[model samples]
Target: MIERPITDWLPLTMKEVEKRGWDEVDIVLVSGDAYVDHPAFGTAVIGRIMESEGFRVAIVAQPNWKDDLRDFKKFGKPKYFFGVTAGCMDSMVNHYTANKRLRSNDSYTPGGEAGFRPDYATTVYSKILKELYPDVPVLLGGIEASLRRVTHYDYWQDKLMPSILVDAGADMLVYGMGEQPLREILKLARQGVPFSSMRNINQVAFMHDARTPLADYNDWSTVELASHETCLKDKIKYAANFKIVEVESNKWQANRITQQVGNQVLVINPPFKTMEEAEIDKSFDLPYTRLPHPKYKKRGPIPAYDMIKFSVNMHRGCFGGCSFCTISAHQGKFIASRSEKSVLKEVDEITKHPEFKGYISDLGGPSANMYKMKGKDESICARCQSPSCIHPVICSNLDTSHKPLTELYRKVDANPAIKKAFVGSGVRYDLLVDDFNKNNNDGNHDEYMEQLVTRHVSGRLKVAPEHTADDTLRIMRKPSFKYFKLFKKKYDQIQEKHNLKQPLIPYFISSHPGCEEQDMANLAAETKDLGFQLEQVQDFTPTPMTVAEVIYYSGVHPYTLKPVKTAKTRDEKQAQNRYFFWYKPEYKDWIRNRLNKLNRPDLVERLLGSKTGNSGKTTSSGNYSGRKKR
Candidate 1:
């Protein structure tokens, strides 16, 4: 291990820039998150990538947007562009809960304080920079920009907003894992190509004047989506547009997509191919301090950084393609996993950190067991356009194996400095169920489950079944609840064999599209029968760029044009969510009343232990305390 100077981090201030002897930075990134120089932090990754590419980069993190705009003008203007992001998460999501309530604390901010960044932070920061600099190009990236690249729903505003570029007034937008497009933009800029002329980069979106002929970029075909105005007027048209966008986004060889918003055309170029092992490794292997910028030492520690400081992400992208999730939308449906050597190197680095205590918090990714798995036939995958690879049924062309991940875990455990490495991320339990995914003839599923239960059980293992109703599960793109039963049986078998007491805490969502109140009641009743008190629950919040959100706004499934009932009113949503707490005394009367109104005496009897009795309060079968609030 080597001691690092303050200069080792990407310059977060003009003082740090002066220490680096930098006269002017090539790029200045403005982010909503407090600067944590870890790869898990998007701002750090983008800034470090630029530095690795021989660009003098400086970061202005969580700048004072509400003040007299001094923070916006501090860097003056970069030589190439000013990059803007709303941190790792969408700012609205970061600021508010699913109920649209303002959260009191921000995990990305120092001292877990809220309000450091404004809502719609990317648009706010970009607008400020455009006003201040006027000439320097404003480039938008990160999840906020990536998911909102086109016409999409905004849950907070309860409206279908046009592309973020239309409001942010930026020169260009780089969506998804931005390393590939970012490098291309940098190389072209180095050749003296102006940013305005660099519109052909993949995974980049920009507003083109509708009157002008679109630039001819290779021989790629284009798919025209319904205009923003049309989507606003017609919900059916909006729903249809999402299907096209989703399919194209997941395809390996995808068509360029365009949509008219007012006088401008939004052109979203197809994404770059999933990064190769070496490509993703290069981004992770960059020189990061792996700690928050030292200036925040007095402000107190960042909660998000604290949680993952000792964790190692094994891969990028998720093929699970859960409808409610934005992971596949932003990271793509293919998995780009890190090499074993790269993961081990990171583990060793974590061991050397002063705060590490012989434990690796997580050895997982978006979905823990998706490491190094992909389609068996490249040609089939290249031509396919389905948004999900393992929905309805697992594709035979796809390879679902847990051996690579299991082996990786064992190797990490064998490290002399490591006491335990846990898989903290949510596991896709369906992939391990033999009835659902038949690709496990090698008994890898059983072996992996045994290893995970015996070694990685950090008090309890978490999984997301999302819902129990078959109709709701189908609409959510999740497998039947029967598969979850199979998975739980296997999990419990392994636990009992090893004399372990780790409970499987399953996550469920209420008020999702196609989920009626009766469905929620049935969910509560069945889980009650299975000895679950229903702890991890949420009221679905519609975010941009997901099939579920589209359905919520459109009243119809994006894939299927048929109408799907969703709880829209506040009362309807609250009613559906109340079923999760059937055992609580506060909700016992409400549950009984609601069940009686729905004519579901059977459910009431099952949930309450009797149709009228109130003394039937019981907890989950195991020591499962719900998901802890972050």
Candidate 2:
């Protein structure tokens, strides 16, 4: 391999573009995030990938859309096309909270500033580029476009919107991680193929006339979903469409999906196969500066960059497939892990950084322990249509071993330049429990748990139980709280054995679909009995392309079409959310009153102390036996 300059970050400005003595760029990328030349940021990865392919790529980060349109015209137009993304996260998630309130700061922005990027950033930027450069093709990618590729639900607007490709008036949209499809698209463009004629690429979505012929489109069985007009008039059809969308997304062999938005047809080409190990390893091995762009020096640090600057990602995609999560929808359920050699090389690169702090903040991916994890039988997995591999019960064919991840952890910690390496990503505790891994012979569940508790944890290990009630957990596609209890017991025993005082932080969600006020109260009482103050909790937010969101909006579960009770009104949501803060003095009276009205005075006594002050009387079922104080 030849050596390249360590500081070879892609150009971010016209002056930097001129420094390379290039009069024109082949590709100009636009992003909603501040320019950070790190792999963690999607725009940087795309820019670096294009550069490595011998294309002159320049980036326009967080361009001022409300200004005189100077930012859009800064690069004039690229020879190939303009790539747009809403940064690493979806734009709405970046700008607002679950309660629909605007956030005070954006972690992706320098100095944690807010308002740098507009809402619906991909659509906004794409529209602006089309307005300025009418002839230039606008290509949309990233989480925003990927999730909103077809007619889907929009939480902020509380409506079923058409595909973003239609709304933005862009030529095409690239869904999922763009490396594979993007390379093919650029290659076709170089061969003199026009953008309008480039609809055959996999993982790409585009609009076509409803009456277009399909016979000439090659070998692909097309599945037409309910039209956008029908979905707008009836949400049940919309919910039904998502079921098909999710199933096709995870299958090894899937049919091309099409939907009609009025007279125009929105066609989503089936995604390419999951990136092989070598392919994903190559992506992580790109020449990233591993630092923020120099232009952001005066703007203070980008919070998102600073958090993961010293960290490393070992894999991509998640198979857990929680109902509220979009990871499976975008990245797919297939886990694509990087080679150990590739990961260790990146760690060595981090050690050489000038700002090395003798610490690696994280060494994990979407789910920490899911590295190299997949189905034991490839044939079964290829035909499997289940959204979650571990849900309902861990699949017998799935490989739930933690040995690879445990060995990788030891290798990273052995580096002399590193003092400690922590696992910051949320771990799926169910995978670590013996009950869940009983089917696998060499799972080494005990060893992995011991190693994680003894080494990787930084004072506390975080896990997402999501909810305590079995009904809610089932709806969330998460394991029951019984597994949580078993995991906690083992965790406590491990802590005691090591003489360590690390706390197990469990995350929970309030006001989720199928969760009643009683469920929240039960959660509070159960967690309180376990001696948890319950600091980390959230009210469920309804995002697009998620089962929970479908249930929230349609009032019917997508899988069974059964009516799912959801807290829609502010008062109902607030009432359930208050139970999460039962320890607070102000909420105590409110919780007590709410429980009392439901004829559950026992919960009030359990959550709130009685006059006798013995923390109330405990029943055989672990709940308080006494009634509320008069």
Tell me how many clashing residue pairs each candidate has: 0, 0
Clashing pairs in 2: none
Please report, in order, the local distance difference test score of every candidate based on alpha carbons. Answer: 0.89, 0.86
| lDDT tens readout by residue for model 1, 195-294 | 7799888999999999999987967899999999999999999999999999999888999999999999999999899999999999999989998888
Kindly list the per-residue Cα lDDT of model 2 for residues 151-246, writing each as its tens digit.
Answer: 888899998899999889999999988889988987898898998888788899999987876444658898889999999999899889989999
Model 2, runs deviating above 4 Å: 1-7, 215-218, 611-630
Pairing residues by index, what is the TM-score of model 2? 0.96
Error of 2 at 404 (Å): 0.9
